[model samples]
Target: MLVDQYNPFEGKMLQILDQEGNITDEKLLPEIPDEELVRLFKIMLYTRVIDRKALMYQRQGRMLTYAPNEGQEACQIGSVYALEQRDWMAPAFRELGAWLTRGVDLKTLYLYWYGNEMGSKVSEEIRILPVSIPISSQLLHAVGLAYAAKVRGLDEVSIAYFGDGGTSEGDFHEALNLAGVYKTPTIFLCQNNQWSISVPKHFQTASETFAQKAYAYGFKGIKVDGNDIFAMYAATKEAVDRARKGEGPTLIEAYTYRLGAHTTSDDPTRYRDNTEVEAWREKDPVKRFRIYLEKRGLWDEEIEKAYVAEKEEEVEQVFADIEQNGGTAFDDVFMYQYAEMTPILKEQYAEWKAFFQERGML
Candidate 1:
């Protein structure tokens, strides 16, 4: 197993693909079909396109504060590709790639960032939680989902995605501790992007590696090359397989770098240097994946130009639809709070209705 071979305690990280798209660890490379690989590459490309457009929208005042997944495509896309439809996911925001892969509608994602509740109104069949803004709280929710599945004798698994900063939160420790005792099928995916906002990871904890923390919780842990999709896929596949067999949880620390600011509201230039960003840009996930596709004769400049154009057009069209018809229903804000509105809610709703009516805006 990858966890057994890549000892986090020993500072051994699993890396199957290199920057030039060469298979650095042939033994560990996941056996992915050519068609599936091409599909995955398309999704990864779409993810980057969406992120770039989202950032542009935010700057143009068309969207709200956004988190850019500029360079972490492999970590999100590769790991999520390991999941089945029956599985569940709890994302700590910034997982644009995973959201798309899980069949979330573009309108839903945009509507949410458009500051509408409709975005969180995910189709029940998708089996994914809404974007989690509260640091490590989703870990607990994922654990609960896994535990419930365990008790019900279901084959479903639960995966939670968070950043390294979340590891410092008590909920992280609490969730892992609970999963450890219950032997739940939970996969804790930590995208160690090396920076949590302006705070570098060095300040978060003194642990040699985030994966090692799983040992403390009585489970296995593995560190992986977050930039290499092959490595992420291989590691997540093992974790998912183990979880399906009721072998308990595993912690996967995806060692990667955030090549963008923490959020649209923050300025990365204020804290980090261009030299650092440039260095990470050289390891951009999208570029390397494209190289891999090219190496396999699956992609070329003509194909990239056409595919990127199509993706960008689709992204723009989706956002345009959201702009035209994605406003959160006026009643949704009050109605979603409960099956039946409370008396105070009714009063407030009526008050707002009356105010809007007075202004002829209702």
Candidate 2:
């Protein structure tokens, strides 16, 4: 029959489960206990609910433009949970789930979307950077942190999260090159959701797969089923452990789909079809994980109800907190810039504060 020879690039790739909720590789599965699995599920549910609420808030003009991580919860949660508390996280926009999993306050996330810069005033104790919106710029920051850690003889690693579109940026290549040369402890986590805003992955690059690019950088590369929480956790755990052990960086390409608009300001219907969205919905990460939980007799209707109710209450409190704080204030904007504000910045701040006061808006 002259069947083609097998290649790592021409295979189904590494995975622990299928969309039908069947375990395909028992040995590669994560050793998550039942309680931990339940907690993971609850976190995903909470994120989903929060995303929905944020969408509603945007429509009601209560929040500025917001990005929704509707179907990629498992990818974010699994990857972040796999990291140690000492490890750093440098994220691009659309990493709400990762930040929340890393102990960022839900109210802070809400405040960020509400146009408050204070939302990004993460505690110095938390090893997370302010959300980078300039595409792949954070990759360099992650590499720099990794290099510094290595120079200081620190075992900590830094994980940088970006989308498929980010791979095309010059900063991405530069960061990877530096990480490779320095053998920094950095994990380049690329969430290939198949779309970068309205641009589809196929148009983003001609490469067969995003993971293959890692070969040019002389590092291990992996492509996993992003929708599978088990696969994500296992792969990330291995990468984090390797980095902590003084191994070089790894490139993890999570092949997943974005089930909603890129952001509230975007409309996917203009660039794609409903059929595609419907197809990905069938592989919903939350639903698949729920099915897996059910098969093990670990999930029930009562649990589902209770979880949803609790999530709703939590989201409600976040919204109330944001609203009561008058959303974002003008003074909050000038607090984080520098120890001493520049004269120009001080003048601008005073002008803004005066303008708000004149309108009785502050």
Candidate 3:
């Protein structure tokens, strides 16, 4: 009989703050200024407000489909805050929290949801790529950019944000392989929100844990409690530091839950039970973080009300700007694609112009 090797991959999930706003382990707490912790809490509030506004906008028919990251705010905000301004981010569609944390203007984010192509054009200096809607396609772009930085001798790392669904994509495999081979400075942040639309995580993959997938690529893969801001920040900060020191990539699987529908168009209740949603809501990132802040004397009911009102005013102003700016032009499809319009594109543009002209709408 042949002896069989018992190869079991054991990955521990890191959680600093528990469901009741208490620390699970004091030793795992990340060292950061008191003000920064407050800022993180504020960002979570901002994200939740904006996300609710998105749903309101969709209901009012002012915007198209939007993927709300209401329950996963800490996962995005904490990891993003850990990055240096010089680092690059390649985002999947539901990265509003991350973008906001990285200083992406609310107008820019709103315009993108409004279906304007110009919103995709981010400044090179901002280092945030246009949102990639094709699942894990952006991971390849992130890996390529990280490899380029290596070639150019730039000490910048790239982060790719994608959902649990993205891990099943071929692009994920290719990107991780390339990063492992070249030892590229990259971080793959997987927001394992437990659902890919109507599909539950178990249906998506048979793997025991998504983080262990990193071992096959020859790097560290950590599973962090996505609801814990401190844990998310600590994990990301450590991975970022290693990457900056040319220690290659790290895959962080943030185990979270989507407390809302997958998108504005989705009816999650048709598939998932209310009990499941309620259970996840109990593990709410914002509530737990707020509890922690309260325990530290950093927050209270009065402050919460005032801070929410202030953020609401800011959101109203963003909507006002969007209303004043108006919608995107129909010809924007052909106009933004190339620096100089190609002859073929020019002909197509003219055809559309004539079509709209004949209808007396142009």
On TM-score, the candidate that comes out on top is 1
Q: Rate the local accuracy (lDDT) of all candidates.
A: 0.92, 0.87, 0.88
lDDT (tens digit, per residue) of candidate 1 on 1-362:
78998999887999988877788867777889999999998888888888899999999999999999988999889999999999999999999999988999788888889989878878888999978899999999999999999999999999999999999999999999999999999999999999999998889999989999999989999999899999999999999999999899999999999998899999888888899889888888888888888988999999889999998999899999888987778899999878799999999999999999999997
Q: Give candidate 1's whole-model lDDT.
A: 0.92
| Candidate 3 Cα RMSD (Å) | 4.0
lDDT of 2: 0.87
Arranged by lDDT, best first? 1, 3, 2
* TM-score of model number 2: 0.94
Report lDDT (Cα) of residue 119, candidate 2: 82
lDDT of 3 at 314: 91
Q: Which pairs clash inside model 2?
A: none
TM-scores for every candidate against the unseen true structure: 0.97, 0.94, 0.95
lDDT of 3 by residue, 1-362 (tens): 00011122544678889989999888778898889888878888988998998899889998889888889999999899889889999999988889988988788888888888878887777899988989899999999999999999998999999999999999999999999999999999999999999888998889988887887998778888899988898888988989999989988889999999899999999999999999999999999999999999988999989999998899888887887784888778898888889999999999988998999997
* After superposition, candidate 2 runs with Cα above 4 Å error: 1-12, 350-362
